[model samples]
Target chain A: MKQDVVIRTVCRLIVPFIQIFALYVIIHGASGTGGGFQGGVIFASAIILIGIAFGLPDALQRISEKTNTLLSCTGLYIYAGIGILCIIFGGNFLGYSFIPLPLDSAATRGLMAEIVEIGIGITVMAVMTSIFYDIAVKEDM
Target chain B: MIWEFNFALFLFLILCAIAAITVRNLLSAVVILSVYSLIMAVLWAEMNAVDVSFTEAAVGAGITTLLFIATLSRTTRRSED
Candidate 1:
């Protein structure tokens, strides 16, 4: 897609703010509404926007396949890692009570929720970008 | 935050849905579908689902429109029926 230079410039400016807001959602999920799945998809949109206006080559240049894989895994593992931490702390598997944060158990739950959101965001970003790339690579017209 | 503002968005989506399915021209229908997606995105945002609203705006309004446009190239732009 050959976007006008002005359109491309505008998208470049706007998309990063979208990403930042997505991160804000992910972080504040416990305090507000939307959790992991929702925040994740939003964060992914930033990259997708870049792909839309600038094309896949430019988008991919910024976010490599390797980084995508790593982040996707990291997001999921953050969730899993907590379970492992709970077990190591001699508590039930995935139990939030075992968390040793400075705050109360309720606050700990909030922290855990944020961590999982981050993980979900990474995975969503990667998978959605993959979808965009697949579309971009379709057979000739 | 804006309950009255959201009522307008809801009405917009309903209108888009009606236009999408009721249109005679296939290309026009497809374009309406994209509009429906955008309206749906706005509705989601009004409901405070920023995450979902964002995705809907990006995918529904953005990618899905492209998909419909691309498909339009290969398919007939009007229903024969």
Candidate 2:
């Protein structure tokens, strides 16, 4: 598939832009038409595009299974860790207003929300990509 | 709301849905399903559910298509019925 010059060139030209757009969606979730789930899926789609265009081996090399597994765990931990932090700060779990950031409560809550969104995006992306990998990988039966 | 455009999209959505179910070829049915997802995304966008629309476009049209194709490669391309 990589030998196909047109597909290779087109994918190369577009993948970076797609990733950037996905990041934009993730970060701009607070103010615009995106959120963790949408952004994460978009990002995973870019990788899936690469996997389709190039091949599974090439894609797995870019993101090894071990790293993907770790990332999935890390993303979930970040979300749960934030909730725990909120509790330790004398608030209910996930109650961002009580987060002791050096800002007004509302502003701090907004920041925490963004952080949680990022964490969710990471987990979603990792899990989606991992599922694709598991399903798409060819077995030597 | 642009009632005319929404009606047109709904029409296309219904057509695609029927085609997807009735098509004998599994691969063609998958393609039709992707089209259905596309129309649904546009409908969501028209209704101002931009987030849902974005999700539909990405997951439904993109990743879901790939997954279907992958599964197709592992199985028969023709439907029994």
Candidate 3:
């Protein structure tokens, strides 16, 4: 399919804002009405829009399949690592209070919660984009 | 104030849902489905489930619509009777 100039220009102008808002949702989930799942899906929608506007090749250049796979793994590892960290500190799995940050335990737990949310967001965004890419691309003869 | 707005959203949601299922052209059905998703997002927001609303808009309205269009491009536009 041929790319439309208007669509490409509009998407270029809008994508950055969408990404920024997704980040805001992720970071503010602790205090507001958002979380990793919602933020990640929103971020993936922006990337998917880029793919629709520019084409699959352009989107792949921005985030290759290899990079997507790696990021998915890294995100899961980060989540699991936090749980292990809590275990090491003599707390149950995912007990953020055991993290021992410079702040008070409650604040440290909040900080850790945000980190966990980021990990979940990364995995979700990568997986959704990868699934779309795999479905949309045509196989070579 | 809020209840009236919610009632309007719910009405629109039902209309979109019926349109999405009954439309003959595949592309139009997809567009109507997207509208349904958007309306559902608004309803969720009205209920204070911001996270669910955000997910519905991003995934259901946005990505799913794109994927539907992509698939539509690869296949027949008309539904076979």
TM-score winner among the candidates? 2
Highest DockQ, which number? 2
Worst 10 residues of 2 chain A by lDDT: A132-141
Per-prediction TM-score: 0.74, 0.95, 0.92
Residue-level lDDT of model 3, residues A1-141, one tens digit each, is 438899999999999999999999999877788888788888988998898888888899999999999999988998999999999999999999987778998899999999999999999999989988877886430
Error of 3 at B8 (Å): 3.2
lDDT of 2 by residue, B22-81 (tens): 989999999999999999998888888887888899889988998898888888899986
> What is the Å distance of residue A72 in model 2 from its true position?
0.5
Candidate 1 chain B TM? 0.87
Off-target runs (Cα >4 Å) in candidate 2 are A1-3
Q: How many backbone clashes does candidate 1 have?
A: 1
Selected candidate, larger TM-score, 1 vs 3: 3
Question: Lowest summed lDDT over 10 consecutive residues: which window, candidate 2 chain B?
Answer: B72-81
Which regions of candidate 1 fall more than 4 Å away from where they truly are? Answer: A88-93, A138-141, B1-15, B22-27, B37-81
DockQ ranking from best candidate downward: 2, 3, 1
Position A53, candidate 2: lDDT: 85
Model 1 whole-model lDDT (C-alpha atoms):
0.75
Clashing pairs in 1: A75-A119
Q: Is the docking of candidate 1 incorrect, acceptable, medium or high quality?
A: acceptable
TM-score of chain B of each: 0.87, 0.96, 0.94
User: lDDT at B24 for candidate 2?
Assistant: 95
Chain A TM-score values for every predicted structure, listed in order: 0.87, 0.94, 0.96
